[model samples]
Target: MTKPTLYLHIGAGKSGSSSIQAALARCAVPLREQGFLVPGDKLEPDATVSGHQLWFFQGLPKDEPESQKKVLRRLLRCKNAMAEQECHSLVVSAENLINRRKFPDLFLDVDKHFRVVVIAYLRRQDQYIQAHWQQWGFKSHPDFDDWIANGLGDIANWDVALADWEAAAFKKQIIVRTFERPKLHGNDVVLDFFNILGLDGKTFDLGNTEQNRGFSELTLRIAERNRDLFDGPHDNRFFAFLGEHLGSVVYEKEGGSIHLGKEDRQRLLDRFRAGNERLRKTYFPDQETLFDESNLPDRLELSEAEWSQREHDLIWRLLFAMHRRK
Candidate 1:
């Protein structure tokens, strides 16, 4: 029997991961026919982005003994399924896998089943922060300034993260792809991933939808102020409706760009410059720069008081929307 191949899409985060996971789940049956097995539907249905999340969650350090026992069973089940399918390759994708320091140890549990390959996509540092902040700001008070001061280092420092993953014992070849659309193969991440795997597009049902669109700063600020209202269990349905409606309402006004103060932008660029350069030289010798920085914009042209007024107005509108839902 041919040794199976295991491909792990370890995301650099905020780089279209939801879309990729959805694509894999959507095309599972067709993929299996082509000898690629993406197992996880038993833990989560293919309709959701967390379809392959069990593999990632199981890999993390767990405090509960019962849960740890389940992890081994899960791995054994996956191996058996692969054997039954006669699959030559298996793929498990999750953004959390990219930055997890204990990544190598996590895969040691299943390394005997297959040869491992790590695939990742890196986004521009500035864009990565804005995208991440907007997502978290919707659920909590992801203070932008605080993130810049404390969280930026890990998120922006691709070199360190990549280096650690490369050093991991389970890692075979690490395929690094830039998240920029123009730079991506066929201008689509899903297609580009298929290219990396050398899979025939006609062999799989390659359908996809855009997922996790970024919220505007104004929308995020409003969401942050009212985070308590949506944080509880009662708010899940309400937020689901809000997420759908808000996209259309904000679509026209959204510039699709996160504004940062010129000084702050320069600070971010300078901070990541050496690290990004080293990353490119180490992994992408042909590329001069890891990311494009020419079009970064200055902060939104609004004073604090004016921005606060807008927040108040947005809160009122949000309350009205909730009332209308009732």
Candidate 2:
């Protein structure tokens, strides 16, 4: 009998992964009808709503041998169930998989059973860093420059990060998609992913809406200031609450969010120029550049006076809003 194909979506985070996962979960029935199995539904029913967290745990630290064994057993059970159900394909998605250094060894059993196709989405490094800073870095490193200087920039080295997966013994192929709006199908990541799966995206129920919402620059600043209140950087509930309440606030001040100056942005890009070029040649030979840079703006740095004033006004507004609410 022919081995089933496994479509593994290893997210380079902040790349609309949540939206994709939600859509996949919602359309589990439709996908199974088409012979594609979303393992979460069969192996862990609750995971269909929360995402493929079960699979994600496999990439966690190797200290929990029992937990790892449990996950492996569940995966094997899913594989057996798929065979019984005559499912020819499987889809397992988890953004955290991108961080797994031992991906090849971890998925050796999976590779033995199914033909593995690794799917990943890559965002421009500058945008990625900015998004990540807002999402998690603010809790630990309030200053964006400090975050980058203190080794966060290393995550943007896609070539280095994906090299191990590329060379993985079981990988049949690796699909690398640029997470830019223009590059996506129908200007949507969900549509782009369905296009990759050779399915009609319009037919699937996309659920209520998109999964994650971005934080405004103002909210990020506030969150950074109050990061100590949270348990840790992963204290998503606090961050989400702040964004939900303050994300839409417009300071209407002289300066916008703190962004890397033109020179600094160019330097950051230049730092990874060689590796990006190599990636472009190897995966996207048809394209001249790995990322489209035509629309990037040269944001000016805010003067200290302007920044201080903006912060003062923002705090006053927030305090007044809270007082009124009470």
Candidate 3:
């Protein structure tokens, strides 16, 4: 027997990857009872439960190519170990496996284990670009506009991402989840994926949506403290510690909207309009036949003040009390 295996949960930029991973980690025991080992190698029922890959970038020396490669090697070893163990299922989650200047060792390592199907839930491009910017800003990556400015030339092209995935033998399972549909209503988005795997319906109870209702005060605090990239890696202890604390406030931030200016927003929307069309033609030929992008929010931006609130700490405490740390 080939042994039941799957290499999935690849994501498009920032569509609830953290939330999904965190939820799965939270539901580890119950899900395992149904026969799915979220992170097969952990040997525990938990998914490679904590930490985000982008956090590692906070530890890299900006100008050092050798240093970049070294950290990636470390990332790959950890991901590979998680994938190789014998189990009914396994999942690896990371956003940069697509965009960055290059991929981490996890890409190659994932290839060796199972037939990989890339699960990328795409929102319209305009929203994606804006959300990416909000993230950079929240993480203290210079002025928010600066990151968007640099995203022009190659960044406008999402197809390049498809090409990169092709190199790793990954097939795209791009589910264009619209903003209107589930609005990520609750566990629907997650349960949909679970059903794709043919798992039983023991459904997950999603926690409060308020705590993650934007980046939160905690994230803003860290970004403020670690604003300089060049000065970052030297503060590994700071980043690691702050990161754990920040993790608490990372639930989905509901309301608030970012204003990326009409011109800039339209320009990005146009790019995604064109780019998404190309994605349909070049990759997912029959987009209409595949998935709909119409309802997916055109732009899911996090307004500036959304991250400025101090009330987040109190909310974080409450969230931890209800959910507790894993």
Scored by lDDT, the top model is: 2
Candidate 1 global lDDT? 0.68
Give stretches of model 1 more than 4 Å off.
41-50, 54-59, 63-73, 137-142, 151-153, 170-172, 232-239, 251-253, 256-259, 303-326
Candidate lDDT scores, in order, read 0.68, 0.73, 0.49
Q: Worst 10-residue stretch by lDDT in candidate 1? A: 42-51
TM-scores, in order shown? 0.81, 0.84, 0.59
RMSD of each: 4.1, 3.5, 7.9
lDDT (C-alpha) at residue 242 in model 3: 41
lDDT tens readout by residue for model 1, 1-326: 56678787888667878778787878888787787777773432222333366354645456545444455566566667777877777777877767656554555555566677888899987777777666553354456677678655576578878778777664347888889889877788777888788875545666654665655667655556666667642244444566655545543344444346767777887888988898788778998788877777766676789878877776676778767777
For candidate 2, which ten residues in a row score worst on lDDT? Answer: 248-257
Who is ahead in TM-score, 1 or 2? Answer: 2
Name the lDDT value of residue 151 in candidate 3. Answer: 34
Total clashes for model 3: 10
